[model samples]
Target: MENKYEDYKNEIKEGKRTLNQTRKELGLPPINGGNTEFINREIAFCRKIQERR
Candidate 1:
């Protein structure tokens, strides 16, 4: 089976979708504090994965 989380990550990495869009698709609530620490972490993780390739 395919991994939805990984697919969403790829979408973000490829600029096919925004972090908020992915979050909504994943049934997650929007961040209210304007603190995107989690989103930034995920983006950083994606960049690392791309660099490894």
Candidate 2:
């Protein structure tokens, strides 16, 4: 079976989904306007995923 993380990453790469959307699909809480720290962390995680490509 394909990894869900890989699947989500590919969906993002293909412009089929945004990070926030993927997070919601993964059951993560949405990052709100005041959640700068969570937003930055998610951004950093995305950067790392991109680096792996």
Candidate 3:
């Protein structure tokens, strides 16, 4: 499937909005992907849970 962000170029240009602002205006999350700390913490937690099984 095509990536959806590619479809936003003209709307973003016409609105004079940054990608982050566009996402916010569309009621999407402020960040597209989780940050490094959240990702690392999730990985560590999953590893700990797996070790108990």
Q: Which candidate achieves the best lDDT against the true structure?
A: 2
Per-residue lDDT tens digits of candidate 2, residues 1-53?
88989999999999999988988988887767898898789889999999999
Give me the runs in candidate 3 sitting further than 4 Å from their true place: 1-34
Candidate order, TM-score descending: 2, 1, 3
Best by TM-score: 2
Residue 15 alpha-carbon offset, candidate 3, angstroms: 27
Q: What Cα-based lDDT does every candidate model obtain?
A: 0.83, 0.89, 0.72
Show pairs that collide, candidate 3.
none
Which pairs, if any, clash in model 1? none
- For model 2, which pairs clash? none
Better of 2 and 3 by TM-score: 2
The residue-by-residue lDDT of candidate 3 on 1-53, one tens digit each, is: 55656657776777766777877767755554656676577689999999999
The TM-score obtained by model 1 is 0.53
Which segments of model 2 are wrong by more than 4 Å? 38-53
Model 1: runs farther than 4 Å from truth?
32-53
